[model samples]
Target: MDSNDGFDAATKMETPLKEYFDASTWARIHASLQGSLTKRGAGNEGTRQFLDLVLLKAESGIPWSDLPLSHSKIHNVYVRFCRWTDDGVWPPVLEAMSEAPEAQRLLEQLVRNHMIFRRSRKFRSEILKAS
Candidate 1:
């Protein structure tokens, strides 16, 4: 059993099994998620990448070997799959795109919609006016 092969790097460098989050399909999903989605353990882009792969598995079907180490590793996994159900550290860029002009229109058309609000409306308006 040579651990120094390339197995470690193979899964490490490669992205998730599915393509749930991409520019072409972000608006619909994000809005469906209610403006933004924060998975339980999802943190940074890597976690989101992993979750997207998990998502693909749920939608289509995944080969056991393709799952992450947490789901694949027979010994012990550093991160688990279910831990990140909905937290808040996923992708802001993708969320922002859901609110973009084009995407916003599409999102409104769909049942799900992104509700944008400002904590301080007056201040925000002033800032916008200044800019």
Candidate 2:
């Protein structure tokens, strides 16, 4: 069997989130998230990398540990994500970005996938504990 096993080339070639949005659209989304990012003390490039890592995770349905090393540390990104969720920063940012249809669709998919992944992980942990 090939080293890639069950994975397809497209999975390996996953594009960065920034490429999906034009410069103007990205600027809008970035602007929308700027306050939260700044409050977290994340610089522009770091914030972009963090967002890209998140989108990649959502799209790939991969475990946090499986995230590429080239991106920010997985633990840091995951913690930031949880903090954003707890602080309710995502909804308003997502709402603001929804003005762009493509961005809206992609963000919706990311949200849905992330939710499903979280539920499944919780269920699996519960099953393990029960067993």
Candidate 3:
């Protein structure tokens, strides 16, 4: 696989959130979170990366040393996840993994997976199931 395959112009612009994600990643995200809220605005780059980080952390079960947060990206992502999953976002960020059809299709093709939630609202860890 090409490590550079998913890199886009946005990833090279000091986009702390965008570095770990791409358009294809966005699509799967949309589909995965279909009914839930906090989807994301049409061109909100930061939110896109933020959402990507959330999913990545949720799936990888790894230590978050590369996110743009002081403590840990996983903590931030869990907070956001509970926020979105609970009452949902006020304006709704267009976050479902299927929000973008093209990205949805490609990402879905690349990945087929689900998450295992912890006992509490806060996630202890996340594991990614292979396609």
Candidate 4:
């Protein structure tokens, strides 16, 4: 019996999520976002993880409650996202990211998701007021 089994480098595949950005592109994104997302004692790694989860939600259009547990708690992520939106943090970041060819598609998806979210909230509010 050989120590090495069926693992084959050639057969390895990356998930669709991982295909979004290569190392270099991701680094550029991280650099661009660092100023806004940085927290004392927490390094760039945390921002990277948080951004990954945000991107996942934006790309999938899934409800926050449906996010995977491995990524932080749904409430925490949602709250942070809302806070950022209300604080006007995303506009500049998205604008800067739009200039990068590698980030354009992802930025478009995020923008679309944000618009849909806003419209749905407005509709719900209108329905509540009419009742």
Question: Which is the leading candidate under lDDT?
Answer: 2
Off by over 4 Å in 3: 1-44, 63-68, 72-74, 88-131
lDDT of 4 by residue, 65-122 (tens): 6666433466676776776666566765566564455456665667566768888999
- How many angstroms is residue 41 displaced in model 3 relative to the true structure, after the best TM-score fit? 8.4
Off by over 4 Å in 1: 1-3, 8-18, 21-24, 34-51, 63-66, 71-131
Q: What's model 2's TM-score?
A: 0.60
Q: Report the lDDT tens digits of candidate 2 across residue range 17-112.
A: 444456676677777776776767645577667767776776667877777652346678888887776576777667766556655666577766
In model 4, the clashing pairs are: none
Where does candidate 2 stray beyond 4 Å?
1-18, 70-72, 99-106, 109-131
- Candidate 2 has its poorest 10 consecutive residues by lDDT at 9-18
| Per-candidate clashes, comma-separated | 10, 0, 12, 0
C-alpha TM-score for every candidate: 0.31, 0.60, 0.36, 0.56
Q: Name the best candidate (by TM-score).
A: 2
For residues 15-45, write the lDDT of model 1, one tens digit per residue.
4354544665554444444433344322344
Q: What is the overall TM-score of model 3 with all chains considered together?
A: 0.36
Residue 44, candidate 2: alpha-carbon lDDT: 57
Per-residue lDDT, model 4, residue 91, is 68
Ranking by TM-score: 2, 4, 3, 1
- Residue 29 in candidate 4, Cα distance off native in Å: 1.7
Candidate lDDT (C-alpha), each: 0.41, 0.68, 0.45, 0.62
Candidate that beats the other on TM-score, 2 or 3, i.e. the better one = 2
